[model samples]
Target: MNINKEENHVQSVVRAAHILQLVANSDHPITINQLSEETNLNRTTVWRLLETLEFLHYVERDLPTKGYQLGYAPYRLFSKNNMYLSLIRKARPLLEKLRDEINETVLLSVPKHNGTLTIDQIDAPHSIRPINLVNRLLPSHCTSNGKLLLSRLSIEEFNLILDRELEPITRFTITDPTLLQEELNWVRDHGFSLSLREWDESENGMSVEITDNRNELIGFISLLGPYQRLSKDKMLTLAPKIKSTAKEIAEKLS
Candidate 1:
């Protein structure tokens, strides 16, 4: 790749990015012809763009279905940012407020290289009990944080994760990849995720994704506590508040 030639290829790169965005925005896989028609770019140009993207793992072709979908590059790029930590710092006060309000543990998580990682938490303040979770890497398939992150992926990417074999951490945990994908679909549709004794046998967790003004998923903020104390009704009530707080934080950060 010549330097000037590569610089001149900005048009190609932009079109390729647009193609990825198109695929990501679609609820189902799209064919190359569909992409070309949608973009108003010629077939050859679109094919070249898709080919380049596929080579970089930004797009993957579904051979059996003969459609293309987003690949790992988008996830990799999203996970590489340091803004997640900065967001955590800004979220401390908010987390404290939630913890105080609910008298339950509050956590902030961002997607890491291979799984969701807890970057910050506020232990509930109370006279009788307090749960401490400062730094932990929860199973991506068995926790609320993991579900929120996983919800951002395309169907193909979600299947890729399931193909990796989701391991069960507790009896309530979902170990089947297909079953977990179904749960994730519901989570995405509902705008929140709940883990009932999934990761920890005694703990129940509820999480909502943090997305920027452009609807780009940044991370998630969650509440975790003993299952007995955080009942289903309570979780349902808190879910909207959690999601609202996340949006507020994202706006402030933006």
Candidate 2:
């Protein structure tokens, strides 16, 4: 997505790939002239690349109208790595929409070992929004998303997570295994978790689990922000909305 690339990045290939994407995104087949005008490339160059893509069955060219459409190659390439990609693609747009509704940073995360791993984030435009935590392993015992994941664990697995040293990441972090286990039980009973600065002193986080068609836990959708804005009570009130959005995302996988 970064247009400003390194010197080694080939311009022709990038342009061709962009054009191919443009075609794939279009609702209908596109003309060569439109592709040229959109990319600001010469008609001849666009034609050459389209011809190559068509030959490889990565593009479908209309013989009579001289139009082009996205071919099966792209779908085949992506569908092979479907599970995570499917979840992310379906979750991202909804996460952005939820960010607009609540005006808070939203995140999608999954369990990774005994921790919560953020898969995506849609940061609120507010200057005071919490920092993005995508790809980070959040502490399991003290974070809302982490506890949401841990609450779904089997008895043996739950014991394993509890057996690990529950170090305090922040002043408010629950370092006692019994207390953390009690919190997880509460989360399981209430169907949601809202933590007040257990990860960071000034921030609060809320999480709701997403389930598959079979009602199995898939991941979690979370909101993160300053305690002043996302106070425990305020987050508690938003819990239903967050769970609703997570359910909508679950429906997509079915």
Residues 27-59, candidate 1, lDDT per residue (tens digit)?
A: 567998998888887889888988888899988
- All candidates' TM-scores? 0.64, 0.66
lDDT of 1 at 7: 50
Deviation of model 1 at 145, angstroms: 1.1
Across 1-254, the per-residue lDDT of candidate 2 in tens digits comes to: 44346378897788778888889777568999999888877899999999899988899987787789878998788777655677889888888899999999999988887588887889988888876576678777888988887777888988786676778889999888778788989998999997888889999999999998777879999999999988888898999999899989988878
C-alpha lDDT score of every prediction, in listed order: 0.80, 0.85
In lDDT terms, how accurate is model 2? Answer: 0.85
Residue 131 error for model 1, in Å? 5.4
Judging by lDDT against the true structure, name the best candidate.
Answer: 2
Clashing pairs in 2: none
Clashes of each: 0, 0
Candidate 2: which stretches are off by over 4 Å?
A: 1-83
Which ten residues in a row are the worst by lDDT in model 1?
Answer: 1-10
Total backbone clashes of candidate 2, pairs 3 or more residues apart or in separate chains:
0
